[model samples]
Target: MNKLAYALLTCIVILSLSTSCEKDSIRVPVQTIELSASSFTLATDSVRIVVAQLSPNNTTDTNITWTSSNQQVAIVDQSGNVKGISPGTTLISATSPDGKISASCEVDVIKWTLHKGGLGFVEEGINAMALDKEGNIWICGQNVIKLGSQGAWLMNNSNLNPSAITFDNQGFAWIGSGSGLYRYDGSKWEVFTTENSGLKDNSIITLATDNTGRVIASHFNRESLLGTGASEFDGNSWKYYSSANGLVYDNVISMAIDKSGVRWFVTTNGISSFDGEKWKSYGASNVGVAHIGLVHSVAVDSNNNKWFGTNSGLIKFDGTKWESFTNQNSGMIGGSVTAIAFDNNKNLWVATGAGLAHFDGVKWKVFDRYNHPVQDIRTILTTPDGKIYIGTGLGLLIASLRD
Candidate 1:
């Protein structure tokens, strides 16, 4: 009785102890598995990749499975090294015994390059440039030159000592030279001078067209006559304006038509705006034009901002306020801004007497004569492909902003 009872009691106690130990083990906490990356970039020639994992709750499990959607594009290793083999998109995933998490990135193996074209001159000085919607370059300067693809010269009129040239919506080229206005109809030139047309004077400084194809020319008397500032060609007749006719100055330098069809004139005195009925003048005394006299050129940006290149510096008008920039405040490179053009990227390219200045809305980068032959940049033009052509006294210089 003693031997059998002792053996049975020991067995029962050992069974009870084993059951308690199993229950205590089941109460132990479970940890979570997390995945992370050092970097998401992958090289084209990489063979393997490395990824890190942190098991704050499950410190015993370090083994994880790496997966990828496209093995040809990229493949991951146990260490999380993603090797890029080709150009494609793939999803990388990591899994552990506890849970699974994933992160993905693309791999492009082909090289990216930006090709820029060479520079071409107009053969003669460039006075102005007007681009058509068809990518045809109509250059109005001393010589009437038209350029297109493959360096093709569509029209090269050496007889035109053009002072200002503009293109209408009808593709007709209106040229202003020492003579009067001339229209090129893609075949021949039609001369319109004071001989028959109603031009106030023979010398035309600038030419602009309204939305209705009405042409306007800024005329200055070579003899320095006062009260003879501007003239307009209404398809048939010419109308002249001056101080006697409510003009601020008799010597007009530039002309521009705003988005609202309002004509703006820059004269030797200040800036004048004409709404086809009334004329309003603004100068240093009233607005912040930098100078009351000698406003050389005027251009309107896509945002309806007015840019004035005056004898003093550059002035910008935001319809409500005027902001002036010079060599001191802005990296203008020169005090006298001669021409201004806005590129497709909304960057303002300013040509001054010293060099070329580029304003990316916030920052300014000045390219002087030392870095580029930008001195005496009389005109700034942008091609359809975003290439910049600068017309200077030296000749025509081209550069690419993408580079």
Candidate 2:
């Protein structure tokens, strides 16, 4: 490039032609057409990238031509803006009006078609999502991932089968996997298992962080057939609870913390509420739990009302009465509810076996795979940045909760 610049300068000096035949007339050197980059590799999300940078700091010619060898692969405008059209390679050439001193850039476009993005992170079997202290999103699949604005990195916990994820009040992240409960304090990870911590069992299926920063986890205990209850950590010690300690069932799938600081656990038998001192059990007769065999998830709204997802339908209890919303009365396309989450706008996002349902307190909107990318959404979460993260059976997804 330097040699080319010197040659252009020599040509400019050897030329005796001037713009105007007048005394003390200034001469403009030949615009040395040089490109900043010789090649580029971009994604569908990065179509609006600069293809090349022209040299000759002072070139008043607005007629520089930018052309692509294959417009189907990529297209370049006169301003040197390159837009990737497909998953292929193309050569973008820039030429002067006189057809001299030309340069070219090879562009390769890649497509990253995931849930709701063009490219960034791609994974399968995503189930849970949580936010870190820096606002980065952590998604759970076969392992855990810390997804940020820059990109995504997996926090491999020895390939632990992560089932749930949550963030504590102190900005620490807790992951519940089949192996154990792991906590990440940004720098290091602390593992809690039956052999290490106060965990009654090693198969962690669900995790919940209370207002007091208590990390509560549910044990799956499916293989061993010995998981008797759930475990709780007060940032110092571990506590276990089961039928012997007031739970009606030992197979707990999900948990939630209400406004009154009560921890609710969704079990196969019923719902268990713990106030750090006492434990209360509610069944289908009192809490309006239907004949659903399995309770999938649990959540609490801003008003402290408890929400439960079951195979039959969605149940909501505002501390007094339990209301059951199914296909008969609500817009739930599928009767089996898998997960539920509340947005900043007080809207309830529900994931069922058939589609995704949104309730803004007045109406219901359903999004299925036929129209949207939603399919078998397993879990849902809304962050303060107004981004709704949904994990389907396929992979992780991001959607807008905007009306």
Candidate 3:
């Protein structure tokens, strides 16, 4: 009885222990999968794309499938290649069949283009511009132009031969051409030439009006005709002045009236100022103005400081001293400054033959066609809203200072 009982008991215990061990060994493998790039941005032409895959402990799992929720936007292949169809957002997902693990990434497709209201207009060019006291912009450049809150052409004469233009306090626009001066009182164009009105010369090169409603113009002399230094329109009659009347140069290119109602005439040789009483001259000999000595434009800042744009560089007269800035010294990109204007913020905007440059008392910002090239920025004006309008040989460009 003892031998048979002992053998049976030992067999039963061994069998029970073996069954428990077998049950515990039957376990399922855990699956883990992860994506490499959280987000993917691609152009609209990308075809073959590779996304990394991460597994906990299994590397031999080659059975991976990729899919996109929106096939119209993006499509994914079995080899993890993603193709972009259009500009939109789509979710790309990858799954490992063997491990039963899945991962997903967002695909974003975007397109880029040049903004017209920004610095991109530099590729074009500008010609001329005028700013009213309210900071409204009126420009005449390449194509049809306007400015500020109200985009008015300011010159709808349909005649594109205007040489120079000036605006008075009453918002009247005076345009100078080969014929004479044309006045625009926001409605129609009135022609004032040597044949009809009191214009000193028919070939008017520049125009300027004083506070006393006196219109001043400069004329260029050709062979058959005599060039007048300056002319005055006192509402009733026309008065012409030349070298015999103590004028510096007969060939006038530009003109500007200072805060004191004094007329400043710019010529190919030098600069001349005329007060109500006498005429004064300043040029190469007295004022150290260098380079070609040809004054192209002149402007008066808010502080009553006179600024001159010459073929060489820029000069500032503070009544007592003279400060000069050229391409070599200041950040002016070019020496040929064609136009100059002061904004409401007292920032000086200079239009050069090359591009546009701005000076805010301390720093200088130059905008060229390379970075944001504006071709031949003939005129620069700032609106009251701090937006800068550039008149280029191509068309009109508007830039936001807040940017």
Which candidate number would show the highest TM-score if scored against the true structure? 2
What RMSD value applies to candidate 1?
12.5
On a 0 to 100 scale, what is the lDDT of residue 36 in model 3?
69
In candidate 1, what are the lDDT values of residues 119-144, reduced to their tens digit? 24345456677776678776665576
Q: Write the number of the candidate with greater lDDT, choosing between 1 and 2.
A: 2
In order of appearance, the predictions have TM-scores of: 0.67, 0.68, 0.64
lDDT of each: 0.71, 0.76, 0.70
Worst 10 residues of 1 by lDDT: 109-118
Model 2 scores worst on lDDT over the 10 consecutive residues at 112-121
lDDT of 2 by residue, 338-385 (tens): 899998889999988777777888767665543345567888878886
- For 13-95, candidate 3 gives per-residue lDDT tens digits of 99999999997776444366676655555545566465655554545564677889888777988878888676677888887
Off by over 4 Å in 2: 1-122, 225-227, 401-403
Error of 1 at 7 (Å): 81
Name the regions of candidate 3 deviating beyond 4 angstroms: 1-127, 132-136, 141-160, 221-227
Give the distance in Å from residue 188's predicted Cα in candidate 3 to where it truly belongs.
4.1
Q: What is the C-alpha RMSD of each candidate to the true structure, in Å?
A: 12.5, 18.0, 14.3
State the local distance difference test value for candidate 3. 0.70
